[model samples]
Target: MMGHAELKALAAAALLSLGALAPAGAECSRDIAVPVALIGVSITNNNGTVGGIYPEALRAASAKAGCNLVFSVVPRARLEVLFEIGKADILVPASRTAARDQLGIFVPMIGHRATLISVQGNRAPITSAQELLDKHELRVAVVRGYDYGEQYQALIKELAKQGRLFQEVDTVAIARLMQSGAIDVTIMGPTTFSGAVMREPRVAGLMDKLRVEPIPELPWSYSGAYVSRRSLKPEDQAAVLEVIEKVAKSSVVMEGFQRYHRADILAESVRPR
Candidate 1:
């Protein structure tokens, strides 16, 4: 018999295969809507339009695949809802989970780990979520819709219950809160947290006052694209998924990420998890 890890892998493979075997709609739907948010380098407003590393890479992929892709600004919560209901075609920069596996075919795009970030005055290297929980004076800010797996869920649940959690709509807002000293800590990837802070005109210096450390309970997280099962025509969906899988490691994503992160972290961001 297969071990527990192997059994989980087999179950996951079975779930993902459903995307390929699912029946495609007969209508040729080329107009695909992708949701966007102002979070780090993933999505932001550029020249009055949605632009960022994610959009940059995705736009290039869609163009190459002959897919008519449209980017619409949507909050994280509503974004999930739209995709689940078949109103959204793609979910880029979404953290993958087993529950989400039933929704679409997830193609991993980048590898990043959740980190603990706080001001310089506080403690460094929080051993676990429980450690941070003990610091009653430290207020935590969390992006409302992000799912960083089970450990994160438990941490934020306690934070919410204690009324010490300040939920924000996006990472940009969380970064601002960090700078203003309204939030003592926030947990996220280094690329995302730094990118969000640097996007502001004068908050780049916020990094100087920040203390970043690994959270033992929070492990590696992969951000990727999920092609909705009910969105595109069969041929178009396959083409889009193939093109994205390739370009996700190409210059489209790499150079776009370089615009917001250091060379080392960018390498780690795109590293195979």
Candidate 2:
């Protein structure tokens, strides 16, 4: 029975009241009053995919924990800064290395084993690490900052002794370099490189032409949730770690490996040849 103008005014007033009462931070629930921002590698193109599997997996995990989770896709440089400055609430799929641990506490429950290695079976498979020494002039592409980790630093030092020509570039750039034949070798996680190649047919032949050699004694990456001590109290940090561990053990995470193709997406999302 209310007039149109009265109803409109009522709606506006209600909206303004709701806005005033809303929480200051992104709210997942009223009971657990803590802000969370998840940092991960930025995705350039999502292909209608809703931010890729890593983010998707974290979303599922956060939901299980009854926490509101927000995502910030950042470069490795910025990510390091955020953790250092106490801005990052959580870091997903973080590699466990001593250099990184110095910045914050790395939750091992979420750790995943990944690496940046050459794609095998391109033309001839690289059988041994010594082959790198023999191919002195081989052009190598690697992601910057990734080379400095404790586990990876040794590989870089060894490659340096071999006099390999390594060019540092972004992840996508590395893939493009391989596809253009500008670089003879590039590093990629098996899952990422695989997804990229699957999306591009020509890369398949290039894969046959290249050899993927797992860098040996090289520390396989262990990814997990990491939190900045600067941003969280010990109790809150411990709670977040608990959430990560609990979600890691859940059926959703364990059973969805095949569905996610996490390993393949990581390995193949790189340059073809």
Candidate 3:
């Protein structure tokens, strides 16, 4: 039997050693860098500031994994700069295009989808795909460089072949454009559009007038983790991807989303018009 003094010494040593351990965690293997840019639409709030939904989800998971994280809120224009400059370590909810594949390593898909559609008021109601086809000459607002591939570019070619044209703008501009009638219609992520409506008072009147029609099957919103040039190591990337796959198979991330945004908001947040 150990003496009381010996037992106390043992307890102290164990406690001291625990600081060097991985600590209790969900993803115990990785030490992720902080201020990872939660680069997406403004609807995705990071600790209450606007970011993407996945980034918000990632923040919670990072904490549970005992990883310290800081969020860099990035909008569409800045996203390109951040990605190219390698200024940030993480970007979530980016579409995994071959073009992006050239830029950096991405975790495999979270298997999310978003559609491209046009929103119009009840007065100018759009009921069929033909309406968009007919109005192809009109200026349509889309995120700059949003088309995912040659196939997507081919879709654009087909639209152009039929006489449709588009104007590029950030998601915020799309919302404002739709509200003020600056443009006929705009394309954005469903989750982003819904959150924009919730946050902007101008959308209420327009919401009543809004009619949505899917234009094409766009594979634009696959959620994944991104590691910039500096952060891309085989082991680090593997660990992050492993955790993403694990969290995606369960309700852990959804619960985190529900904690931050209302259910109705989330339901429409990423859904097509």
Candidate 4:
């Protein structure tokens, strides 16, 4: 028969062996670096601190996934390059599209209501899409690479073709152009507009001069985390999706939406699908 000490030693060895055999995604030993392209806005930034709802929710989800997240803010155009080169493992708050779907898997998180914003004193009675369309003389500003839905996208394309649309890299730039009378109208989500105003003291007063109008015919745009298959292994991608799905239903994520006055959308995002 084995002695007590010998049995204890054998048990310890077995436990160690089990740990060694554990899957790579079973623990937080590895750090997943997420390269975020959306910068200078509220949702994602290079500040290296969690502030916005999307970043906070992503951080929470990473914790639940048994992995650490390294969020780096890169320019919008550079995001896909980094992922393709295996430098970034994920992209947060990415909108679902056929092109992006070919590169990775997306875990939907929240929805955003894209609203039309204009100068407060503009005399144009632009309450609907048709009214805005009738005013062909007005210059409209929009962020490049943003999808405001199919109908809005078609309108934006038509405006761009007619040279009435201005595409900028960030919202603050668009707001500044509007303040300087360079553009007559722009589209921005509530959280995004608030974040832009809050971050830039120079443009903070621009909020007072702006008014928001809803695009009633368009559906809200849903944003999610895109896990790059090129950067992450299949099992790791599965783990990330699981974590994102679980966190999307958590109270922490719901609180984030609540902070931005978007709790109703959060409820819809996490509902059974």
Candidate 5:
């Protein structure tokens, strides 16, 4: 059986031959990069196998669009820089922001909020960000380059200034820290948190003991994908957009989230309003 890399190479080779006969601007050949920290039920990587809601949706759309995609993994912040410089071609699980609007059109996938997730500890239950901050001894960590919301941004800024924040490369890393008691609290979606715990054997026990609660600070936000204006030629944008639009119109993104997040949480957070 052909491995993933071999299959992708074959597909790219075939696309090149078809590109000649295809109408100009109809073909999309780009290098797509998904951030490493996005793993969970959203983007799962089990050994050499890759499966998840976002990946499934994107893969199907790319094929339909005749997009020649070479998927690579990078750190969260590195993704932002790549998008900014057009070093990258496509983005998924992206949040549309005014700043990002300058980069590309956002095709929304899911609407969700980041919640306060506390690890199992003797510390008093955290009622709010300020309450957690009051205890200077407690260590807090979060996945780097992830933006929760306005309030989350402010809180992390404050935590950073106080030298109390831990920004790790990925959820699995943060989960391991929590398991080791090197971390106490994290701000992220329940789905990602659950996925991280499942991915890391050392943090497997962190699942049941996690304390999840919604705070007014971190409210709902739309997450989606975009095609960089700088990456592909202006004409090729349409093909990339088509790929994004197909995923947005389908229920695959939300369907994938349901496996990890509770129905109520999905309805309240990521499901369409």
Candidate 6:
């Protein structure tokens, strides 16, 4: 099977060939506009703008590529809708899934471990997926559009069928719901949860009330920039991929992740091919 890097190279070459047929100066250039849609809420503040390791990494890559990039923060569902309609050019830090693969090209950027958080005083222990599933009374909260892998996704579906799931708009809302005791437990990436706690004072204040634990059975998944195949021309897709591959390993991007305490989670490179 072709690996991600190999697939990317193959796609780039094919795209470049098609790009040659376009009018002169039609390739990805400074004049070309790139619309980047970011899913999820802002975690940190950057010069009055949303500061996130993923966004910072993307900005670095965009600068390196000399592409004119515009950023918009939207809910995950809305972001998907925009991508499907060819209104968005890119989605930063998107997870790879069979459904998403049909819509765009995913270039791996980082890896994240899904974690479970619950009220500190809760005595019930949830050490594994089965344990959590056994507790039918526990209300588990999750972000609406998150892809938590096939197994977990299936488990979530089962939970939903049992009326034990709470799908919220974003991490902040999940955190807020947990704080208010509206939900029994919630699952999210530690880095994401930490970023939210750092950016929002209300969520930060509830830290002591929450307990975070890793779900070891759940495998780590890579999150990356998903370039819209429907919206961007082949040359544009290749250019964006080139930029992401280059800056994804650069110091600037690493520093951005470090600032958010996500250095360990950042993917060192596209999964080796």
Count residue pairs with overlapping backbones in model 5. Answer: 2
**Estimated TM-score per prediction?**
0.82, 0.66, 0.66, 0.77, 0.81, 0.77
Task: Decide which is better by TM-score, 1 or 6.
Answer: 1
Query: Which residues of candidate 5, in runs, are more than 4 Å off?
Result: 1-25, 29-38, 46-50, 120-127, 260-269
Writing each residue's lDDT as its tens digit, candidate 4 over 82-117 gives: 766777777766666666777778776666557777
Which parts of model 4 have CA positions greater than 4 angstroms off? 1-25, 28-30, 38-41, 44-51, 80-87, 122-130, 260-273
Superposed on all Cα atoms, the candidates' RMSDs to the truth, in angstroms, are 12.5, 9.9, 5.8, 4.5, 9.6, 10.6
lDDT of 4 at 21: 72
Query: Any residue pairs clashing in model 4, and if so which?
Result: none
lDDT by residue for model 1 over 183-211, one digit each (tens)?
88888777787788777766788766767
Return the candidate ranking by lDDT, descending.
Answer: 1, 5, 4, 6, 3, 2
lDDT preference between candidates 1 and 6, better one: 1
Predicted candidate 2 versus true structure: per-residue lDDT over 48-160, tens digit per residue: 33354455566665565556566544555566667666677776555666766766777653223334355453355554446655677676666665532554565556776
Model 1, C-alpha of 217: deviation from truth (Å): 1.6
Top-TM-score candidate index: 1
Which parts of model 1 are misplaced by more than 4 Å?
1-29, 122-124, 249-251, 263-273
What digit string (tens of lDDT, one per residue) describes model 6 on residues 1-273?
999999999999999998776533323653333333333232344565754566666665566555656665567777778887878877666667787788888877655557677777747667888788888778999888777677768878888888899998877888888888889888766656555665678778765565666665566777666788897778888877777776555555445556555443323221221
Clashes of 2: 35
Residue 181 shift from truth in candidate 4, angstroms: 1.6
Write the number of the candidate with greater TM-score, choosing between 5 and 6: 5
Q: Write the per-residue lDDT of candidate 3 for residues 1-273, one digit (tens) a residue.
A: 999999999999998898568644344344554343322333355466644555555656656555545565545556656766666556555656776676667764334444444465344554434555566545566666454455555555666576444544455557677677666665445555555565557564554454444444454355555666555466555555555555566565455445545554455333221
* Model 1 worst lDDT run, 10 consecutive residues: 20-29
Clash count for each candidate, listed in order shown: 0, 35, 9, 0, 2, 0
Q: Please give the lDDT score for candidate 5.
A: 0.75
